[model samples]
Target chain A: MTLETTLAAIGPADEQAMAAARELQGRLTKPAGSLGVLEELSVRLAGLAGTCPPPMPEPAAIAVFAGDHGVHAQGVTPWPQEVTAQMVANFIAGGATINAFARQVDASIMVVDVGVKIPLHGGENLLEANIRRGTHDLAVTAAMSEDEALTAIQVGLSVAGALVEGGAKCLLTGDMGIANTTPAAALVAAFTGASPADVTGRGTGVDDETYERKIDVITKALALHEPDPAQPITTLAAVGGLEHAALAGFILGAASYRVPVIIDGVIAASAALVAAALAPNSVAAMVAGHRSAEPGASVALANLGLTPLLDLGLRLGEGTGAALALPLVASSVRVLREVATFDSAGVSEK
Target chain B: MTLETTLAAIGPADEQAMAAARELQGRLTKPAGSLGVLEELSVRLAGLAGTCPPPMPEPAAIAVFAGDHGVHAQGVTPWPQEVTAQMVANFIAGGATINAFARQVDASIMVVDVGVKIPLHGGENLLEANIRRGTHDLAVTAAMSEDEALTAIQVGLSVAGALVEGGAKCLLTGDMGIANTTPAAALVAAFTGASPADVTGRGTGVDDETYERKIDVITKALALHEPDPAQPITTLAAVGGLEHAALAGFILGAASYRVPVIIDGVIAASAALVAAALAPNSVAAMVAGHRSAEPGASVALANLGLTPLLDLGLRLGEGTGAALALPLVASSVRVLREVATFDSAGVSEK
Candidate 1:
């Protein structure tokens, strides 16, 4: 399908689904009409699924899409690509908060090595790091070719699909990659028409000089590529990393498959913007978990009209924030499925 | 035991637990050290229980303590004491945010009227409400009688005991009551030695005149009852509600039972102060869920050295904030239980 038609034909927010969602507010064990918007969240999801209350499942999958940015050489983040690999090891080791939370909540995790400079030793992590090493220096050229971007997306689709087939009830998007915020800044600035300065944050707590250099590099790259927003694939091709491309596809695929996807922070947010650009209704399957302390995150999420639940000065970009927020999403669905109606509970309405 | 000894006897922080908590941060599925405090949360929990990774069960219970103040008659609150009963219906009906969130997260909710001036229906919920009608006007007499205050604490202990017996793995504390902030305000002032004028806030969005009067009433009440901090029960007897006293007991019981308790906003914080006074270790059982817009919540939590997660500018009290924060706590436990170790995942870790 043509990219525009592909974008246009995605699902809309079904009125029937919304109606079903509203009905669930009154049906759980507690009094009806008491849960407020959390009930609405559940109902909304139910309506989308054409179910009463949605089923929340164990064996959930989180994809920590990792990539490397050319900007790392520019000295924005003090950590090197080796640290990314080391972190991947840490995630696999079960020492991370996401690991702890994932276990506590009984979910599985897959670390997607999307574009690390090092050859990752893959036992279980889906090595979708297609560009072998990392993105091309955005200051010098486009981040990745259109073909590579498309391949990254295919990688995301495969991971999400396999998880769903393996009984994943939900999809959550996470990302890893040192200096990846450079690419995210490019995407946000391009898609949302924000200034590079506005979208660029002191990623990994960079100093004022490095922050200025990072912003300049991104601004320069966006000018060179001049990525087109109307054509999501082209824009992703222009400036997106393999991780961002994969995340966009992951979001779209989850929606197409009819499972909910929870979006993480800026990198995820920028990728989600691409998915939205591709298919408007794909936003329906997405929930904004927590707003990151990252500037671009809030800008992207707000532009898309999604409300984030928590905003605790958190700027970390693993699906950790998203993972942190998942229980709330689960809770939203539970309210739809569990709360009792007024007549059943013998309680009066407000 | 003397109240002083009982408070002192509450267990102190176990360094072994803190170290174990920190170690677990190294094992989760995300990058090493990414989940930060959330990882530590589980680890500390594990250390407290003396388990490598703790047990997570299906059933959980949340207790909401509600109390009214005679200070309400001083024109502090915009709402009346009667609203406490109405909102109790709201909680039961699932119309409240806490109800929506609790059902979402799958926690059983028990509401205690504690000291609401009005009576509830002659039914099961009424049995749990624990309303001694209401507190005495602190401006005139001590808000609660010494005997009544102790009885309220017994009520909290009994409820917590029942939940544990029923196999709850977690305990969450929240509260309701129109004008109860006056009692909360008085408690903050008496304990922190902050000026009553600084601690007294507009309860439930009062206008400027009402706020000024609130400060006046709290100041007068403290003057009337130069409550001793050393005698916590006596202090609570002078200015606390049945719910406040009960909440303190609930926290201690949860700690004693080794169940984690999520403390909600200002009223919960006030009760937590009493809890800390009773036993320093009880704070270990507590997780400060969210800092509410209530001016006193931070002051109280700061006094206890707990950092809040969500900061949604919420003033509505119902244990809703705590309920919302449950997913993170559950994840903390999950990280402990589920994340694969480095050896098993075959990933290298330093």
Candidate 2:
């Protein structure tokens, strides 16, 4: 489906289903409003699914959209750009942290070459959806053309659709891009109207000198772009990575399909800002999986009215947060579907 | 092991292992201190286990200690007193919310009839550890005799030992009682030096009238007992439930063995207070699984210097919160053990 059609079709969550879920929560054999956020989350999922006790969000998929960033030339992060491709290879070879976490949670991983500068040969689990060689250095110029940004977004949309069609009840956003956090902080500042210094954080353990440079890079990019929040595409092309654009499309696609999308850290949160700008209602399908250690993540999540399910101080960006959260998400749904109501359990309610 | 010997044997966590774990965290292929609380948690676990990347806490066991409370006569909760025994049966039948959550986390459940008023027959997973029929009315007199309280604590200590011996690596605390929250709140206030009004909360979704009455009941019980924080056993016998005393023993047992104990809600937190008072070092083995909606839970947790892993507003007491947190706990350890170090992954360090 076209991005425009998906955005146009996005609607608010189903109020009737939400009410049903709330009433059901009260009837469960526990104290009223005792399950706390899990009770609220289950109701929200019901609204998204348009049913009480919504379908279990199982057979989860984590899409690791790999890319390279021209900002890597700015010496923003200590890691080499080639590490993105190497990590992607590690992910496919089941040697990365995300792979280990996904295996534990029974989640499948899909790697998409959205804009990797290196030529990634065909692999069993890799999707060759490269939109370009890599984004231009956002500190010096717009990261990508509007068309390139849109193509990357469509790649995310297609991946989301394919995963959902393949019976993935939940989609998790993952990303692998060198110096990606530079553009991520810039995008978050552009969308959330936060100052670059407030949102920019030390990415990948930068030294004091490199940390200051990273912030300066983001500040310069925002000044050069003067990104309009109303024009998400222009802002995205100006300061966002290809993977970020794709993540936004993936979120939009999940919203169109009424499936839950568990967003990862700073990169995914910044992408969510772009998705929310395009279709505010799409935020209904999003769940902040965990609190990223990055300062920008808190700003983005707060602006989106989302509270992360876990806050274990995670900053790894390869959908690691989402994979760690998979079991909690599944448990939330199981609480709704499997927990017996007071009447069913023959227990008196307070 | 005897309670006194166990308490005496409990020592500080292994500082050598903790330092090693911290050094290992720095080598992981992510930003320094990027994993946030998980990194801290892993180091803590390593200290407890006396090794870096401590053994995985799997094959978890949730001990649901069922009991009745004389506070049921105080009109605190609307539910009938018989529901406690009935729910115990439901737990054993695997029909309760805790059962469902335990299944989701692949953890086993064990129901202990610590003080159920009614005599329970044979059940496959039920442990006949009943100390007495139930505790006396706390508002009028001591909840249990000193001997009864000691016996109940021993029951918990034994359960912890048995579970650890049976190949379970982690122990989660769960409890069932009709008006247990009344004692839980009182225990928390007595231990934490908080005022009854500040620590007391509506239990099992009580009406305004019942909430006010509940607070009054706790106030009156405290006035009569005048529990001494310096004498934890006195406080426990004066106002705590049988299951609460046992849970405290369970926590102490785990600490003595250097095994992790994930405490559930207010009841478990209250028990933790007793455990901490009895053996201050026991808190090292404890992890607040989630923030209980009950105000007393927060006060107890804060006093213990423990931050819950999950705070989904859960007030359900049957180890539901701990069950939800099991996967996250496993992931925390797994991240430390499985995530490739920077040098091992051939990734450049910042």
Candidate 3:
């Protein structure tokens, strides 16, 4: 479906379903609120699914949107840009960290090459939907044309649709790009109204000099474009990476289908900012899987009023954190579906 | 094994294995320390196993120790003591919250009637090892005699050995005792030197009046017993539940076998404190699964130098938090075992 159609279809979570879940939680054998955030999470899932005890969010699908950043030329990170393509190959070969985590969580991985500078050959689980070789250097010019940004987003939407159609009950956002965190910082700043210094962080272990230069690059891009948060498209086009745009679309697509989407690190968080801006109700579908070590991630999550389920100091952006959280998310829903109530179990309540 | 043998068997985690793990972590494809606490966890597991890649902690076993606290007569909790045996029955029937969580994590449940005031009948997975009908009210006198406490601890050690022999790679602590948190708070105060009010919390959602009375009960117990931290048995006999004593032995038993144990909420944390005191090296085998909503849990964990993997505001003491954290604990080791090195993956380092 088109972006407009998806946004139109997305609506607020069902309040009736949330109330039902809350009621069910009180009836459960455990003390009220003893499950803590899990109780709220289950209720939120119910609201998202428009049912009490939302369908078990199992058989998770992870969409790793791989791309390259022209800003990598600006020394935003110490790693060479070629590492992005290599990691994608590693992901395809099932040797990457994300691959191992996916195997542990029993999640299917789909690698979508949205704007990798290096052309990759055919590989199983790889979807080649390159919108461009790479974007323009954001420090020098707009990261991409508004049209190109929209195209990448549509690519994400298509992938989300395909994954859901393939029977994925849950979606996880994964991203891979050299120097992508620079754009993520910029996007987070634009959407959350945070300053460059507050939003920028050490991406891939940048040195002091490279970190300063990365901040300068983001500041320069923001100054040059003067992006408006009210207009998410222009903001994304101004400084967002191809994967960032696509991730936003993927989130919106998942929301349109009323499926829970577990967001990864800073890259996915910034993209979620874009998606939330576009469709306010899309926040209902978002689950902050883990708080990244990246400083900007906390700011973005705070702005969205979402608490991450896991905080393992993970900054690996290839959906490792999100994959780790899949079981916890499933457990939250399972408690609502499978747990016996106080009445049913003949247990006394305070 | 006897408690003395288990304590003697428990030694410090291998430093050489931890160093090797750290070296291997640097060679992984991801940036150094990018895996966050997970890196440290894997390294810790390596040290515990005395190997670079520790054995996978799977086929988890959750031992839910059920008892009734004589403190129930002191009006510390609103719920009746009979609820403890009822919940134990629920666990056997696979209808309790812990059962739901155990099922979600693919863990085997073993319900041990350690000191339940009421006798329970035969059921599969139920272990009838009652040390006493229940402990004496701590506020009035010693919770139990030194001999009874030792017997309960031996019960726990026996259960741990049996579960390990049955092929449980990980052991999770679970406890069920009405008015148990009062004893847990007393234990925390004795070990951590924190005041009773600072450590005491509403157990099972007590009202304001009941909370104040709970705190008073803990304070009175601590004052009456004058429990000493160095003399752990005396302290446990003074104000600890039978489940708490058994849980301490269970932790020591796991450490003796070099198997990791995921400590649950406040009850488990208090028991861990007792275990750590008895065998200082047992701390090496302990993993704080989650920070319980109960205030005392943090103090106990801090004293143990253990940072909980999750802080989900959970206060359910049925090993739910530990069960929830099984995947994360497994993922940490899996990364060490499965993820490729940079050289192996042909990926560049920053």
Candidate 4:
């Protein structure tokens, strides 16, 4: 489906299903409200699926949207831009952390070359969806044109649709882009109306000097563009990477299909801000996988009103956090689908 | 092994293994402390196993110790005393929440009848470790004789040893005893130096009147026995149930074997307190699975200096919370063992 159609079709979760799930939770043998957030999560999933005891979110897929950033020229991050493509290759070879985690959780991984500067060879696990060679230097100009941003987002939407149609019950956000966190900080600061210093953080363990430079880069980009929150497309085009725009589209597409999207770290969180701004209801379909160590991630999650399921201080962005959390999402549903009620178990109730 | 020998053998985790795990974690491709709490968890697991990237804690076994409580006569909880035995039947039939969650996590469940009022039939998953019919009412007298308390703890230690010898890598604590929280509150208050009113809570959805009555019951029991925290065995004999004492022994046994034990809700937390008091170092092997909704659980966890991995507001006495947390524990190890280092992945460092 087109980005516009997907965004337009997004609606609020079914309140009736939520009520039914809550009632069923109460009937389960556990004390009322004892399962904590899992109970609430199951209820929300039920609402999203429009049924009580929603199907277990299994056969999950993590789409690693690989891109390059023109901001790499700013020396914002110490890592070479080629590392993004190299890491994508590692992901495709099942040698990365996300690959290991996804294997452990029995989930599949797909690497989408949304904006990688280098061309990647076709592979069983690789998707060629490159929108451009890479984003323009955000410090000097807009990151991408509005149409380019939209096309990149459509790529994410298309991937989401393909995964769901391929029987993936859940979608996980993974991203790869060098100096990507620079634009991510800008997008978060623009969307949340926060100061750059309050949101920018060392993307990949930068030293004191590079850290300060990273902050200056984001601050300069924001000052030059002054992207409006009312115009999410403009904000994305001005400061976001191709992968970030696509991830936002992926989130919206998952919501349109009424499937839960487990968002990874800072990059995904910033993109979620864009997605939430575009289709406010899409936030309901997103589950913050973990609390990223990045300062900007906290601001983005706060703005989205999402509580991460795990907070092991993760900052990696290649859907590793989401992959680690897949079992939790699955268990939350299993509690509803597999657990017997007090009556069914013939156990006494309080 | 005897309970005394198990307790004597429990020692601090291997510092060398911990250092190795921490060093390995630093070399991983992610930022130096980006993995957050997960990095710490991996180190702790390493220490517990005395090896870096410790064996994956799989083939976990949850031992649900079922019993009856004399405190039921005090009207502490709304749940009927017979529910303990009935729930044991449900557990054996694989129809309880714990059963469902254990199945989802691929963990095995074994119900140990340690102090049930009614005689239970032998079953494939049932263990007859009965110490007595039940404890005496703590408000009127010591809950159990000192000898009986020790014997029950030995039962738990034996179960732990058997499970470990049978190839279970992790042990999860589960408990079932009507009015069990009454004694749990008293035990927590005694160990933590908290007042009964501070630790007692509605066990199974008690009404306002019953809540007050539950608190009063624990307060009176504490006043009558005046159990000394310095003398854990005496304190357990005075107010703790057979299941709680056994769970404490189970914790010690797991520690002696260098196996990780995931403590469940309030009952398991209280037992952990007793175990910590006995061995002083067993806490190193115990992982607080989740934050219990019960007030006493918080006190117990605080006394043990343990932070729960999950805070799902779960008050369930079964191993349901532990089952849900199993994946997180497994993932923490997987990250350490499987994730490629910066050099290995050829990814540039900051």
Better of 3 and 4 by lDDT: 3
What's the C-alpha lDDT at position A272 in model 2?
Answer: 98
A1-350 per-residue lDDT for model 1 (tens digits): 22334345467767776787776554443334434445566765775575666776344679888887776776766666676776676676655556665655556888888787777666565554455478877777777788888878877877787788888988889888888887888899889999998998876677788888888888888888888898878888778788999898788877776788888889999999998887878888888878776789888998888888666555667787777777777776755555555555544332
Clashes of each: 40, 2, 0, 2
Ranking the candidates on DockQ from highest down gives 3, 4, 2, 1
In CAPRI terms, where does candidate 3 land? high
User: What TM-score is obtained for chain B in each of the predicted models?
Assistant: 0.92, 0.99, 0.99, 0.98
Off by over 4 Å in 4: A207-212
lDDT of 2 by residue, A53-84 (tens): 89999889999999999999999988888888
TM-score of chain A for candidate 3? Answer: 0.99
lDDT tens digits, residue span B254-280, model 1: 777667788888888888888887777
The local distance difference test score of model 1 is 0.74
Model number with the top lDDT: 3
> Per-residue lDDT for A1-350 in model 4, tens only?
99889989999999999999999998876778767788899999999998888988888999999999999999998888888887887787777878878877889999999999988777889999888989999999999999999999999999999999999999999999888989999999999999998998877778999999988999889889989999999999999999999999999999999999999989999999999999999988998888888889999999999888876667778898898778778888988897778898777877
> Candidate 3 at residue B181, lDDT?
93
lDDT of all predictions, in order shown? 0.74, 0.90, 0.93, 0.89
The candidate maximizing DockQ is 3
| Model 2 chain A weakest lDDT span, ten residues long | A341-350
Candidate that beats the other on TM-score, 3 or 4, i.e. the better one:
3
Candidate 3 Cα misplacement greater than 4 A, ranges: none
Interface RMSD after interface superposition, each candidate: 5.7, 1.6, 0.9, 1.7
